[model samples]
Target chain A: MKPAQFDYADPRSVEDAVALLQQHGADAKILAGGQSLVPLLNMRLARPAVIIDVGKLRDLDYIRDDGDALVIGALTTQRSVERSELVAREHPLLAATTRYIAHPQIRNRGTFGGSIAHADPAAECPALAVALDMQITVVGPGGARVIAAADFFVTYLTTSLEQDEILTDVRVPKLTPGTGWSIQEVARRHGDFAMAGAICTLTLERGRCAAARIALFGVGAVPVRAPEAEQTIIGQEPNAALFEEAGARASAEISEPLADIHGSSEFRRHLAGVMTQRALTEAFSRAEAR
Target chain B: MTAKRDVSLTVNGVAYSASVEPRMTLVDLLRGELGLTGTHVGCEHGVCGACTILLNGQAVRSCIMLAVQADGAELMTVEGLSEDGQLHPIQQAFVGQRGLQCGFCTPGFLMSVYELLQHNPAPGDDEIKEALGGELCRCTGYQSILRSVRDAAARLRGEVPAAATEGEA
Candidate 1:
């Protein structure tokens, strides 16, 4: 089906894009990879009056290693991120999960910032950001501010970003050398939105769990952080029992999981437990090795 | 009201300028305006890779892109898969390995395989499968298509990548 009529502007610079957004406010939508926004527009799920195409902003697409942090430009496409040598060498989990975002064609066009900005609870990048505790830089009329990953998601389709603000970049710190990460998701098809997914990263010291974080998607309005599960692994050994306990806590801490055509709430909760346990076990093993 | 934007876009190495409505999709412009019908439109959304084409040496969904958005951008269509009247190695592999049944989905598959081979001169079977997973073709079970990609990768690398074998029809 054809999309509703709209005005299109190809802004030559980031400032041009920002000015356009300032003039139009919420009536305008920033077009990046268009993997998410375009589909919504086509289906009339979104009816923006203006579309500011910022895909051509070359300055906004780079992956650089700035000392201790891996800074990714907001417009860096998924393909670029997945193929980044720095990302793969340092934060391989981010690169690995980037490979699973949609599919090859979409990844080639979809941007890292766009996916995070879209803030789909079922999206991989958001869960990745939450799991890794990345920082987002947002620029608006009031200048720019760095937003922490934990505070980024306000609600479903809601973010702390203001209307005139554009996400300029994301800074993700390197995982400690011994840290291990696992991202697992189940979708009806490979490229379809996930039914339920979990991303877990663990750091072990002397074979004891030093730190563990679990971020879940498709289990809540916004991607949920499994706090109770994280608490379970703080002082426990990286053993099967600890994994099982953390998994149970993960499922228990959830008041409700999303129920839709793909799965029941009960099934999602079950999958959460199963995937979290699997991920935690895998992560712990990786931590113990090398 | 503003007039339709006058934009010039280069498609398949040929350049042309046209006045297009701001809302016109790049797929429509390629098929309707420029008269290059290789880019297919399925779902009219990004979910389906049927409208995939190489934009500036990278694959992107034309359905989500406005013709104006692709202005002055280099694009390669399925029709441009050959050079000097010779079939691209990927196309030859698809033909040799029987990657098509109905052929409606063939163009997209070819473009995706071309991309995979470009980035990875030699891709393993799993890598080929991952690259082609985005496109869906019902008539031909993915077995033949996957083989075609492997064969194409072999041919592109100037060394055999995978055997062109079929276990089932």
Candidate 2:
């Protein structure tokens, strides 16, 4: 079925694109890769008066090493992120988690910033972003400002981005060498949205965890980092007992689980604990093996 | 308050231009305006990979992309998989290997396999399965397609292995 009629604008530059957004505001939706927004439009779930096609703005598709982090342009496709030698080596968790986004075809068109801006709680990227404590750069009528990943997702499919702002780039810090990383999810199929997913990253020094980050998706309205879980493993050796306690903490912290055709809230809450335990166990083993 | 945009795009090595409402999907523009009907559209919401196409050398769901989003990008449809009336190696393997039954899923399968081979010149069996997992086929299980991708990979490397038929896994 055809989507409801809407206006389209292909801006040549990011500046011009955000200007169009400034002009149209609530009636305008920025188009990055169209991997998500287009489906929403066709379903009539979204009917913006203006569709700003930013694919022509090639300048926004890039990844650069920014000393402490990798500054990825908003239009960078998940395929690029997942396959980049730099990302795979330095940010293995992002690269490993990105493979779970959909499939090669969808990943080729799905952008990193687009997924973060879309803020799908069930999506893996956003949860990784929150886990990594990345920073998002948003350009709007008032000029550019940064928002931490923790502040980005306000709710399910809802973000802190204002109507007139375009998410320009996402800055993700890289993991130093000898760090352990693992990500896993349970989905009905390989490319289906995850029923529940967990990303675990821990840095070890002298056989003890120096820092740990745990993020979850498809378990709540927004992908949430389990602070209690993070606290449990930090400064300690990751073991079966620690992992079990952290999983229980995560299951306890999830405010209200998300329910859909995939699974119920109760089911996801149960899965959150299971996945957390699995991811933690695997990541810890990798860390200890080396 | 519909807005119209003029977008000139190159499709399957042919240049075309069309002015369409922003609502026009890449699938619509390919079929309705440019007459590239080979890019099939099944699930408009993108769960199905029938509308998959090579957008700037990457496989993407055309149905989920606005036509204007594809402006100035190179595109390849199922129609582009042949050269001078000769089937591409992968396409030949599909036919020679009996990879299709009812054929609604053939276009998507062909495009996806093309991408997989291009990305991994000699992919392992697990890699091949991961690449094809996104596609859903109602016309019998994809046992044949799995064979076709591996066979095509060998043929692309100038090795003609005997077709791995039934119970050959």
Candidate 3:
């Protein structure tokens, strides 16, 4: 299959790319790693009039530790983040999550920001962003502004980003020194989109859960935060019963979940609870280890 | 009509330049424009690894990559595996181990295994499986393919001979 015809532009600078987008408006599509966009283009699902190839923008390819957070440029490949010693040492959750994005070859070309900007509910990076409370920066005709991950994603394959805006970087805070994190997902096959997934980070203080972040993907239009579940576990000791209760609450709170050939609504809800339980258990164990 | 873009890339150590449509994928450019048909096309989407190639020393799916994106990049396709009319060690191992049935996915597997062996000369069974998992082979039940990779690793490391053993075939 071949992609539909589109005008191509290779921008050397972020400002040039944003200007191109502004000129074309919604008719333009930003090409980053092309792992996701190329497939969409080849399938003719995305028929953009113009494609702005920002993959060559060296200015946007970097990973730096800025005090409390790791600021990753939008053009940084997923493989680079996975192999980064800094990421492995500080943001182990991000490192573990990148491994689950896709097969090795795909990860070699797929970019960190592209995955988040694509906003696939089943994708690991977006879910991790939501779960970890990462900050996203976007540049447009208006100016550069930082948006919280919670506000960035509006729905599946849709984000709050404007047509003229280009995602510049993502800032993911390093995990707390004593916190435990786990990413668990269920996919029909390896490298396939997750049928249901859960990302959890837990901080235990004096034998009680001081802070917990629970997020579910493949269960809603957007990656869903389980506030009820988080509320259930905070200040409570981590235990089998508490974890099960939190998981059930997390699943129950999602009023509507996606359903298709992959799974039925009921099955997805059930899987969400199971995945959440598994993530919590694993995360608790890691907390103990820490 | 879309404007054609001029792309110059080195494929298998041979530099070639072509003016392809902006929408033309690298796999199409390789097979149609450059006549490098050793790379197969399957699923045209990125799922199938039939069109896998080495783009600047990393194995990537060419079907999803545009030819223009590879401008000035060094690429290695399946055709690059052999020299002087002799099969590459990986190819020889595949044949000796009966790793292929239809031989459609061999190029991609070879390229993938090529990179794997470069990084790790002696990968364990799980590592081998993980690397090959990116590419799909409809035949051989995967056991022989696994054996072939192990054999290739041994041969590449000089732990085993390069020639096929006697099978009375």
Candidate 4:
């Protein structure tokens, strides 16, 4: 399938891209990597009147260690993130989770910011962003503003970003020392989108869970942060039974689990619980080893 | 119709220039305009890896990328694997290993393997599988393809003579 005829512009700078977005507004679509958008275009599902190609904005392709966090540019390809030594040393969770994305071919063209902006609930990037409390920066005609990961995702395939705004970068805080993390998902194939997934980070103090964060995706419109599940684990010694209880809490917290031809809502809920349990179990062992 | 844009790029060591519409995919430009039909179009959407090729030495799905995106990039296609009517070592390995049945998915596999070998001259089985994970092969159940890549790796690493693999075919 061929895409519908559309006017194209490859802006060289972020300011020029923002101006184009401000000009075309909702009628234009930003083409970064085009791993996801091009497929939609070929299918005629996204027929934007204008396409703003930001591929020329080389300034937006970087991975910087900003002391407390890693600042990744919007145009940074997933392949770069996967292979970054800084990411592997500082945030191994990011490197491990990125491998769950489609494959090398797609990762070579898919941008880290594009995945976050696309906000696909089944995607690993958004779930990891929510779990780690990452910050997203968006640039508009007014200037740039940072949005909390919790406020960034609005719903399925939707973000809080305005039509005239372009996501510039994301700030991922480094994991505190002695913190253990795991990202687990159940997908039809190794590279396919997950049916349901869970991301967990655990910090243990004196053999007791000091802090726990749990996030679930592919079961809701947005990545669901399991506060109740985290509460169940905090201040308690992690055991298989405790992990089971937290998993149940996480599954029960999903208000609206998505259902499709791949799996029913109930099945996804079950999978979310199973994934959380597995992730927590693994995270706890790693934390104890730390 | 959208206005056509001029693009000039190097493919398989040859420089080419062409005018393409903004919506025309890189695969379309290669097949229809440049007449490089080695890169087949399976799923125009990015799902199938049949349109895979090397852009700037990295393997990518050409079907999802616009022709204008390759304006200044160097590319490699399946047709570029051979030189002076001789099969490349990778192609020879695939033939020896019987990596294909219908052969429609061979070009994509070859391009992907070429990139994998270029980066990792001695990749393990898991590494090979990971590199080719996106490609879908309905025939041969991928076992033979896996063997072919392993053989290709050995051939490229000089562990196996190219003629030895070709003789096995």
Candidate whose lDDT is highest: 4
What overall lDDT goes with each candidate model?
A: 0.86, 0.86, 0.91, 0.92
Off by over 4 Å in 1: B83-86, B158-168
Residue B153 CA displacement from its true place in model 2, Å: 1.2
Worst 10 residues of 1 chain A by lDDT: A1-10
Q: Report the Cα lDDT for residue B139, model 4.
A: 73
Off by over 4 Å in 3: B161-169
Model 1 lDDT tens row, B84-159: 9998988888877888878878888888888877878878888877887888787988888887887887788787
Show how many residue pairs clash in every candidate, following the order shown.
Answer: 0, 0, 0, 0
DockQ of 2: 0.77
Q: Which ranges of candidate 4 are over 4 A from the true structure?
A: B161-169
Q: Sorted on DockQ, highest at the top, how do the candidates line up?
A: 4, 3, 2, 1
B1-169: candidate 4 lDDT, tens digit per residue: 7788999999999999998899999999999999999999998998779999999999999999999988999999999999999999999898888888788888899999999999899899899988998998887668778888988888888786343333322
Residue range B1-169, candidate 3, lDDT tens digits: 9788899999989999999988999999999999999999999889879899999999999999999999999999999999999999899899998888898988889999998999999999988877777899887668878888989999898886545635632
Among residues 3 or more apart in sequence or in different chains, the pairs in candidate 1 whose N, CA or C atoms overlap within 3 Å are none
**Pairs with steric clashes in candidate 2:** none
Q: Write down the TM-score of every candidate.
A: 0.95, 0.95, 0.97, 0.97
User: What lDDT tens digits, residue by residue, belong to model 4 across residues A55-168?
Assistant: 999899999999989999999999999999999988899999999999999999999999999999999999999999999999999999999999999999999999989999
* lDDT tens digits by residue: candidate 2, A189-218: 888999998998878899888988889999
- What is the Å distance of residue B41 in model 3 from its true position? 0.5
- Model 2 TM-score on a 0 to 1 scale: 0.95
Please tell me how candidate 1 rates in CAPRI terms: medium
Q: Candidate 2 — which residues are off by over 4 angstroms?
A: B1-3, B164-169
